[model samples]
Target: MKYKSFAVAIWGVVILLVILVPLPTVLMDILFILNITISLLVLLNAIYAKDALSMSSFPTLLLFTTLYRLALNVAATRLIIGQGDAGKVVESFGEFVGGNNIVVGAIIFLVIMLVQFLVITKGAERVSEVAARFTLDAMPGKQMAVDADLNAGLINEAQAKERRKNIQREADFYGAMDGASKFVKNDAIFGFITVILNIIGGFIMGMMQNSGASWNDILEKYTKLTIGNGLAVQIPALLISVATGIIVTRAASDEELSEEIISQLFTGPKTMFVAAGACFLLTFIIGRFFMIIVAAFLVFLGIRMQDSEQEKIKQDEKEMEERTVEEIRKPENVVTLLHVDPIELEFGYGLIPLADVNQGGDLLDRVVMIRRQLALELGMIVPVIRLRDNIQLNPNQYVIKIKGVEVAEGELLLDHFLAMNPGTAEEEIEGIPTTEPAFGLPALWITESQRDRAEMLGYTVVDPPSVISTHMTEVIKRHAHELLSRQDVQTLLDNVKSSYPAIVEELVPKQLSLGEVQKVLCNLLREGVSIRDMVTILETLADYAPVTRDTDMLTEYVRQALGRAITKTFITPDNSDVITLDPQVEQLILDSVQKTEAGSYIALEPSVSNKIMQNLLKLVEKVAQLGKQPIVLASPVVRLYFKRLTEQTIPGLVVLSYNELDPSVKVRSIGMVTCS
Candidate 1:
């Protein structure tokens, strides 16, 4: 293994020597043979490769081989023009391959050069250029596909990473080939020029050195050697050119090139019989015995192939029947149906264009972006959203589902723009009025011609795709807690464990079980907190886990630990308007608290609970009147109980604890919720 590199280094050294130093004909002959062998091997390897990436280094190899061949050409030129004798390889090629006739040898050399330079090299170069361009263009779509698969849990992180790496490798390989192809192209040009210079220079040198030789004698001798040298070098170059063409044009397949060609070509036995009949008819004019034999062989092959194909089809059908019967008999087959997707978007047939890429529907791309947006905002991976067409719905209607149950549904005017009055619109647009599905704000679905006028009047305009994407994004945020499972928590833990090993090692399994950790994280997500900072959450859990395994209490500690983030969420720098809980009301809630093995809750009488609810509702409405969100501020101990008390009656309300606020933020108590 160590000497392998040493041997390659020596090969490079030898090429350099051939270019710069004069060498013996014996060494020239050997190097000439080596070049031919390498070229043939490269051609064979290219043919056998299952895919272009299998020979990713071929582009670089193309450069080395071109240089090596050119170096040999220079040495052969030196021997021919300066000494009038290149080598045995050149001499034999000139005499034997050329049939000892200058015209024949020259014709043979020209034919090889033209075929390689014009046909194979030209086509390979063009293919390389196109392949490189297309491969680079497709990279982003391929990367997103991997991400979609990973998010859907179809593949793990490691597999996703490997796929991404391969995508990069493929792009890099094609790009290099695009440039390396020029080497072969220019090599052919240089070979032609070298041959021309060699013939003219050899002729002049031969005549000048051999003073007694006639012009005919000099021309025949030098031309034969020159043609021979060109033939030997051009044959290998032709092989390499063919290899370049084969590699760049090869698509990924399970079988080698030869096998794929044979299988695909002979797929229809009927075509073979038709070709045999044509050949048999041609025998009358072209050849009698020869064409008859060719036609007979084709007929025999076709008959055998047709019989084999029929038998294979019968065997396949029998196996498929047996498999189907076995599957139907097994009761365990029902287990597959029990699994449900975490999220799904089903639309009517008329709205299929929105999810179809062929029709310019960017809905699938938008779904991928929605997953990314939620991951960034909530610090958790969003589940893959399944998109399917549902026939039972209205033409323009779509429904969003969580765990196989519909939670939200909306309708769209596919060819119109959704324009919402941002409260500053100069005038109402003339269009069909509707409510924005995401936030339930009043909007108008205006035609394309009315879009500019709507925007000019200060309305917020969005397309149909954006409407659904925004709605889906908001829904995912609201129910992110439900979508997160124990498995998701473990995945998150495994991700951060690499950077914060001690925090995770000290906190999970030892301090709290996976389910307990999952509950605490779920609680945070339920209240809308970004858990992107896993280190802090785990550290807080480790510190408070031993004292209380109560998830609700542990969540409170985690909130306080993430106080800065929580403060940023609710408290703006200029205005922090919040309703405060009265000390007496807080004391009353504490007094009515009840605890059980399951958990704790308030055991207050209905009348007492009703009074607190009425006061809280009045305060919440009062804050809304001031053009600010209604946030209830309470002491750390009373915050959780108050939130639970009001959450069902007043959903989407913001509740915060005093400890969860950063010390730098100032709070203004707009109103107080009290049971006086």
Candidate 2:
């Protein structure tokens, strides 16, 4: 761990030194050899790797190794150009390895380039792309199968969940490999560039220095050395490319590639006998004594492979048994259960297609839009929703949950449209009678054929997804208060600190706790006033928090700060809102109120509470008839208590404090809540 932390810094320094300064011949020679050795080690590991994900760092490793090779090329080029020789390694390559012939060395280089660039690199890239596409495309179905097994009792909940997680990991692994393959392609291209620079630059230096006997002498010496240099680099590169090609194109096998090939190619003695006969015939026809020798070797290898495989199986079984016994000895209470997802949507088998992206389902996309919308409208960063299928549900039913607790649920007809009755219209549409889950509005679930007819009859037509989305929206909005934690408050403050740091620093801890601010925001959300304008809300808290630490009173002041935003959203185009709150009824409620540190509530007589409830419910009906949101404007002192009272009877009613209204917005008189 300590070494890895400093590895990048050390490499960075090495790269700078290699590029900026010339190195001694002996040191340069050692580093070059080290480079080749490391490349061989990486290549061998890639070949033996059983899974692509095991080589997940291949792309990053490719970049560093490629950089190191480039640096080595630069260092070696300087050494050879400055003097007649580079190092012992380069001298040996030019004399012994190249056979002192440029063409022989050049042909070796060309063959390595051709094989790595055209054969291995291109094939690996194509395999990566196709594998990525197929893996991603299969995820939805794979997840659905896991859900099926869980619901059918074929597997327990834990087993099915583990399978789903593995499927996701596999998809991610292939996707990463698709991008990593590009590094190998670029590395091959760069190898060609490196060779040209060395040869061209070396010749110019040799001629310019007058350190050679003649032009021919200079040409021959440099050509041998350059090709030898190219040979040293290209061999390892070719090996690595072949290893990469092997890793990306193979299927997952229980054994290593060599083991699997040996096991399958000559699994039984019958195949070995056939091979021995063929070799025996070759020896009789001509001087092919080696063929008979090879046949005997093949027969021996076949018998040995079976014995080795049997021993490996027994060893594996013994190890697995020991591990199982060790695991079983642990107490059952020590095993941990899974953590809960903050938001989850579970649908039944019939509704699986609605969440499957491959089948043209846009529900998941719509979920992205939902989070964006809430952030815009409510100033809240909603958590990611986990959408999965559940066989435990009825075919058409779905449930929405918060922290693993089912909060809201609804049913959808996959092939039908929900046509809701627009209250102003008297006409009735024929279909399956039902009520909208979000608001309990009178609605009918009609088939696709009746959609146009229903619209023609003045009904508001909506698709199944839209119906569910609306319910999801409302359920989330209604529960937004509970969702706001102290952490959520700190997040809001931190966001403000980015744009308005001084304001948050001065207000929090100095004036009130995070719980206090969270309470203020929750109070506003409970009344349907959007907290989207967080800047204003926080500023308002900062202004009055020092004077009074009461969250309820502070929430009222924050509401006033957000008056413009609230009125713009709730008021009509003419900037007008209709509300009812008779002063006499308000006074009577205030008179019955008792104050506490948290807030105040109306504790009226049973008869008085009854009178207030009846009139409020009547006013709600009246406002509904006028097609306006029902609101009751009151003093801040009584606003919170008034809301508590109405929620039990007329839950959709919007109760606002008078100061919450913007001065510029107009108000119209509606039915006043008088004690009738």
Q: How accurate is candidate 2 locally (lDDT)?
A: 0.79
Q: What is the TM-score (0 to 1) of candidate 2? A: 0.55
Worst 10 residues of 1 by lDDT: 97-106
Give all candidates' CA lDDT scores.
Answer: 0.91, 0.79
Per-residue accuracy of model 1 over 1-676 as CA lDDT, tens digit each? 8688797678789889999999999999999999999999999999999998899899889988998999999999999999999889999988886675678778877888898899999999999999999999999999999999999999999999999999999999999999999999998899889888888998899888999989888888888888888877888988998999999999899998999999999877898899899999999888688988888999998999999999999999999999989997899988977999999999999899999999999999999989888898899989899999999999999999999999999999999999998677898779998999998989889999999988898999999999999999999988989999999999999999987788888887898999999899899999899888888899999999989999999999999999999999888955598899889999999998899999999988899889889988898888876667888999999999998998899978889999999999998988888886
RMSD of each predicted structure: 14.0, 17.9
TM-score versus the correct structure, for each prediction:
0.58, 0.55
Task: Report the number of the highest-TM-score candidate.
Answer: 1
lDDT per residue (tens digit) for residues 1-676 in model 2: 7699898789878977987798888887887788788788888787677877667777667667767777776777777667757788877777765575667777776787778889988898898899999999999999998898888899998898789877887887778778877877877787787667667777788889875468877877787777666666666666666766777776777678788887688777667877878888888887778988988987887677667778889999999999888877767734644567778899999999888889888898888888899888888767778998999999999999988999989899999999987765557768998889888788899999988888887889999889888888888888787777778778878888899888888878888778888889898877777777778888888899878888777887888788777777777654255666778887887788888765677688889889988877777777777676776777777787787777888777777777777787778766677876
For every model in order, what is the number of clashing pairs?
0, 0
Model 2 ranges off by over 4 Å: 1-338, 423-427, 574-577, 597-599
